[model samples]
Target: MLTRILPPPGPARLLTVITMVMSLGQGLWMAINAVYAVTVVRLTPGELGISLGVAAAIVLLSSIPLGHLADRAGPRTVQMWSFLALGPLTAALLFVNGFWSYLIVSSVQAIAYRAGNNARKAMIAGLVPKADRVGVLAYVRAAQNVSVAIGACLAGLALAAGSVPGYRAAVLFTALTFLVTGALTAMEAPVPPVPASAGAAFAVLRDVPFLMFTALDGLLVTHALLLDVVLPLWVLQHTDAPRWMSAAILLVNTAFVVAFQVRAARGTGEPKAAAWASLQGAGCVSVACVVFALSDGASLVPACLLLVAGALVQALGEVRQAAGSWTIAFELAPDHAQGQYQGTYKMGGDIGKMFAPALFAWLVLGHGALGWIVLALAYTGLGAAMPVVVARGARMRSGVREVAAAGN
Candidate 1:
C-alpha cells in the first residue's frame, strides 16, 4: 500500500531522522525560551507578551528572504549555513540581559530557524515524488512529535536532577543537534536548482491555485492556534478545569495522530484527496469547536474526549491538505523555478502565522460566544471550499502536460 506511491522506506528513512532530530532540538529549545523569560528578562505577562510578539515578527520578516535563498543556492547550502551558525549564536542568548538585546538574539535565531525549516521542507518537495508527499510527510510529522516527547522527557529528568543549568545544557543539546543535522544535510547530493531574483518571490503568488491554497491555509490556522494559544487562556480564565488541561489536551491530540497518521495519509489522489480531507477535517474540527465553545461543567474526562475527537478530525484534514497542497504546488511549479515557487508558497504560510493569532483572539474577546461561532464557520467554510477548488484545479493545465504534448 505504501510503496505504490511513496519512495521506498530506505531513502525516506533519512528524512525522517533529520525531522526527528529537529523536533528534539525544538523541544529543548523551549527551555531556552523559558530560561530567558525567568532569569534575564523577568517579564510580566504584558511585557512577555510583547517579547513573543517580537519573536513572531522576526520569523515573518525572515521567511521570504531565506526562502528565496534556498531557491537560489539550493536548500542544502541554506540548511548548512543556517544551522551551523545557530549553536554559537544561541550562546549569545545566555549573555543578553535586556529587551533590545533579547530582540537581537531572538531575531537572529528566528532567521536561522525559519531558513533551516524552509530549506528542509523545500528539499522534501525536491526529493520525494508527488503522490508520496502526504504519507511521507505524515511520517515526518509523527517523527517530530515523537521526538518532542523524548526531548521534553529528557529535559524534565535533567531539570529534576540539576535545575537551571540543567536546562542550559538542554539548550546546548539543541544547538548540537542543529549542527549535526545541518552537516548531514550538506553531505547529501545536490537538489534540483531554483531560480531566484528578488522579484521572483512575489511573482509566483500571482497564480490562482497558489493564492487559494494560502487563503484556505490561513483560515485553518486560526482554529489550530486556538488549540495552542487561545485554549490555554480560556481554560485559565473561563473554565474551572485544572492547569494540566492545556497540556493534557495537547497530549491527547499528539497521541491520536501518532497512533493513526499512517492509516490516514493514504488517500484518493489529487482532486478527490483535497475535497475528502477538507470535509473530514472541517467536520471534525467544527464539532470540536462547538463542544469546546459551549463546553462547561466538566470533569477532565469529557474535555479530553471532545478535544481528542476534534484533534483526530483535524489530523485527517492535515493529511489531505498535505497531499493536496504538495501535489498542486509541485505540479504547478515552473520547471526551471521549483525553488522560487516553493519559497513563494511557504512564504504565504509564514504570512498566515504572522496574522492569525490576533485575528482569532480578536474574535474570542470581542464577540465571545459569537466569536467561536465565527471560528466554527471558518472551518466549515474551508471544508466547503476545498472540493470546489480541487475540482477547478483538476481542469486546469499544468506546465508538465504542455511540455510533454508539444514534443515535435
Candidate 2:
C-alpha cells in the first residue's frame, strides 16, 4: 500500500528524501527561533523584526545572481556547497549575543538558503522528466510537510521544557540536519546541462508579460499570510471559539495537504488546466473567507464549526493553488533558463510574504468582518484574472519567436 502511494524509485525518491530532511531542520528552527531570540538572546520584538526584514531584502537581491551561478557551474555542486555552508551558518545562531550579530548571521544564512533552493529547483528541472516533474514535486512537498510536522513536535518538547539547554539542543539538531542533507545531496547523480540562448545573462528579467503574471500570482498567494497570521488572531480576538482551535486549523490544513496535494496536481501539468485549477482554488478560499467572517460574532459551537469548515475549504484552496503554481512556473520558463526563471518565480512569493503580515494585519485586525469581505473580493479578482494574464504571456512569447524567425 505504501509503495502504491510513493513515487517510483530513482531521482524522484532521493530528492523527496532530501527535501524531507532539509525541511525538518527548517521547521524546527522556524518554530523556536523567534521565542529564543526574544527570551534568551534578549532582543526586543522590534529588533527581531528589523533583522528579519534585512534578511528578506538580502535574499531578494541575491537570488538571481546565485541562480545564474548554478547555471554556469553545476546545480549539484552549488546545492551541495550551499547546504554545507548552511550547516555552519545555522549553528552560529547559538552564539548570537546581540541584535547586530543576529542580523548579520541571519542575513548571510538567507543568502545561502536561497542559493541552495535555486540550485535545487534547477536540478529538478534538469533531472526530472517533464511529464513527471509536477507529480514528483508534489511528492516532495508532501514529504516536506510530514517531516516538518515531526520537527515541530520535537520543538514543542523543547518549548515545554522551557530551558536554555533544551532550546540549544533543538538548534544543534537543526544544524545537524543541514549537514546530513548536504552529504546526501552530494551523493546524488549530477544533472546534465541544458542548452541556453547566447543572448544575455539575465534575459528573464525583461519578459514583461511573465513579470506581470508573477505579480498577480504573488497577490493571490497572500492567502498564506491569511492562514498563518490572520486566522489565529481572528480566533482569539473576534470569535468565541476556544484558543486551541488555532492549532487545530493548522493540523487540519497539514493533513489535507499530505493526503490530497498529489491528487490535486494530477491534471495540472498543462498551463490551461493549471490556470483553471488556480481559479477554482481562489473561489474556494473566497468561500472560506466569507464563512470565517460570519463566525466573528457567533456562539461557541457555531464558531468552532465555522472555523473547521473554513479550514477544510482553505486547505482545498491551498493544495490547488500550490499545484497550479508549480506547474505554471515550470511550464512558463524556457528549458535552458530554468534556474534563472525559478529564481525569478521565487521572488514573487518572497515579495508577497514581505508585505503580507503588515497588510493583512491592517486589513483584517484593523477593520474586522469588513476586512474579510475585502480580502475575498481581492482574491477572487486575482484568480479570475490569471487566465487572461497567462494568455497574454503566451502571445508575447509567440511574438518574440516570430521576430527571431524574421531576423534569421
Candidate 3:
C-alpha cells in the first residue's frame, strides 16, 4: 500500500521526501491561509482575493525567466537558493498582522514557490523510466498528501493552544516546515540537463504538441477553479450548511488524493489515456454541477444525495486527471528542457487562475445557478473537446522524434 513517507530512502528518495515535507508544510499554511487572512488579518474576501491575485501575478511573470535560469545554470542552482531564501522569507510572515504585510510575504512566496515544485517534477522525469512516470507521480501525490494531512493535524493542535491568533502559530510552523525542508534540499546533488541554456528552454515551448498540452491543461485548471470559488459560495449563501462543510469537502478530496492518486497517476496506456481523461473530465464537470445545483435547488434531502454522489465521482476524476496530465506533460516535455517545461507548464495554471475566479464570480452573479449550469455545460464541452486535442497530440508525437537528437 505504499505506506512510507517517500519512496525507499536512497539519496534521490531522501531528497524527494524532504522536498515533499517542506512543500506540504507550506501547502498546509496555504490550505489555511485564507482563514488567516479573513479571521486574523481582517481582510475582506475582495482583499484576500487581491492578495492571491498579486501572488499569482509574480509567478506568471517570473516563470519563464526563472525557468530560463534553471535551464542555464542548472536546476540545482536555482532550487538551492530559492529554498534558502524561502526559509527566512516565509518565516517572517509570523510577525505579519495586516493585509499589506501578508501581501508582501505572499508575493515573495510566489516567486520562491515554483522552484521546488518544478525542480522536483523535472528531477522525477529525469530519473524515473518513461512508462513509470505516472506510478512515480502517483507515489509523489500520496507523499505530499501525507504532508498536508500532518500540517492540518498540526494546525488543529495549534488552534487548541487558544487565545493567540492562529496566524502566528500557523505561520511559524509553516515557515519552519519550509526552512527545514529547503535546507534538506541542499543536500541533494545537481541533476543538470544536456545543452543547458536559455535558448533550449524557449525552444521546447515552440513544439506544437507541448503547447497544445499546456493550453489544454490551462483550460482544465480554469474549469476546476469553480470548485474552489463557487461551491463554497453556494453552500454559504443558499443553504444552512455549516462553515465546516468547506473543510469537509477539502478533507474528502485530500483523502482521495492520498489514497488513490497513485493509481490515478498510473493512467492507462497512451492509447486509452485520452478517452479516459475525457470521461473523467466530463464526470468532474457533471458532478460538480449537480452538487452545486442541488445546494441551490433548495432541498436538503436531494442536496445531501447530490453532494455525496458528486464528491465521490469527483474524487475519481481527480485521480484520473492528475495521472493523465502528468503522463502527457512528462511525455511531451523536451528531455533536456524538462525543468523549463515543468515551470512553464505550472505557470499556465497560475495564469489561468488570474482570470478564472473573477470571471466565474461574474458569471454566477449575472445568472445564479443558471450561470453555474452554463459554466457546467461549458466545462463539459471543453472536457469533450479534450479527446481531439489528445488525438492531435498523438499524431504530432508520431511526426516528431520525441527526443533532441545529436547536434543540428
Candidate 4:
C-alpha cells in the first residue's frame, strides 16, 4: 500500500517532492491571503476579488502559449525558467499596497505559476508511461494535499498573532519554498524528443470534439467551488453547526483524497474508463448536495452529522473527478503535443473557477435549498453527458488516424 501510494523512485518521485513543497507554500499563503489583504494591503473584499479575478484571467490567457513554448523548447527548459522567474515574483507580493499593485504583482505571479504548472504536467507525462501516468499524478496530488494541510496548520500559528509581521513571515516562507522547488525541478533529466507533428501552436483549439469534452469536464470541476466557497458559506449562513465545522469539512476532504485518490485513478488509462469514473463522481456530488441541503434546518447534532456526511461524499467525488480528468487530459492529448493539450484541458477548470463564485452564490445562496437541487441536477446532467462526449471524441480521433494512415 505504501509503495503504491508513493511515487516510484525516478523523475516522478522527484516531481512529487517538488509538488509537495510548492503546495505547502501555496497553502500557507492562501490561508492568510484574505486577512493579509484586509489588514496590510488595506483592500476591501471587492477589490481583492477583482484583483484575483484579473490574475486568473491572465493565467487563462497565457496557459496555452506557455504550454506551446514548453512543447517547443522541452518541458524541462520551460520549467527551469518558470521556477527562476517565480522566486522573485512571489516575493513581490509583499509590496502590494493597493489594487493596481496587487493586480500587477498577482498577474505576474499567476502567469509564472501557470507556466510552471504546464511544464510540470508535460514533464510528468514525458516521465511516466501512459499506463502509470494517472496513478503517478494521483500520488503527486495526494502529496500536495498532505503538504497543504501541514502548511495550513503552520499558517494558523502565524495567524494566531494577527500582526503584519506574522503575515510577512508566512509570505517570506512561501517565497523561499518557490526557490527551493525551482532548484529541485532544475535537477530533472532532459525530456525526450516529441514528434514533429506536435509542434503546432493552437492546433488543439481546432479539435471540436476534444473542446466539447473540455467544456463538460470544466462543469464537473466546479465541485472545487463547493468546497472552497459554497460549503463554508452554507454552513455559516444556513446550518446550526459550529463554525469550526467548516475547517473540519476541509480536513475531511483532504484525508479522503490522501487515502483514496490512487484507488480512484485505477483503470482510467482509457477514455471509456475515465468517462465512467467521471459519471460516478458526478453522482457522488449530487448526493453530497442533497446531504448538504438537509443540514439546513436540522438541530446541531444532526446538522454536524449531515455536514460531515456531505463533505465525505463530496471528497469521494473530488477524487474521482480529478483522477478521471487527469486521465482524459493526458489520454486525449496528442503524444507529441502533451503540453499544449494539457494546457487547453486546464483552461476548462480555470474558466469554471472564473464564473463559479457568482454562479454558485446565485444558485445556492440566493434561492436557498432549491438551489442545491438545481446544482445536483446540473451535476447529474453533465456527468451523464461525459461518456457520450468521450465516445464522440474517440470516434473523431479514430477517423483522423484512419485518414492519416490512408494518406501515408
Error of 3 at 151 (Å): 1.6
Give candidate 2 regions above 4 Å deviation.
1-5, 193-197, 398-408
lDDT of 2 at 214: 80
TM-score for each predicted model, relative to the true structure:
0.85, 0.95, 0.85, 0.95
Candidate 1: residue 301 lDDT (0-100): 64
Task: Name the lDDT value of residue 354 in candidate 2.
Answer: 87
lDDT, candidate 4, residue 57?
A: 82
For all candidates in order, the CA lDDT equals 0.67, 0.86, 0.69, 0.86
Instruction: List candidate 1 segments past 4 Å from native.
Output: 1-9, 41-48, 157-162, 195-202, 297-308, 314-323, 365-370, 390-408
Off-target runs (Cα >4 Å) in candidate 3 are 1-16, 31-49, 94-103, 157-166, 196-201, 240-243, 269-275, 364-369, 402-408
Residue 372 lDDT (model 4):
91
In TM-score terms, candidate 2 sits at: 0.95
Residue range 350-395, candidate 4, lDDT tens digits: 9988888899988998877899989999999999999998888888
Question: Which residue runs does candidate 4 get wrong by more than 4 Å?
Answer: 1-5, 192-199, 403-408
Q: In terms of TM-score, how similar is model 3 to the real structure? A: 0.85
lDDT of 3 by residue, 6-33 (tens): 5555544665577577756766686677
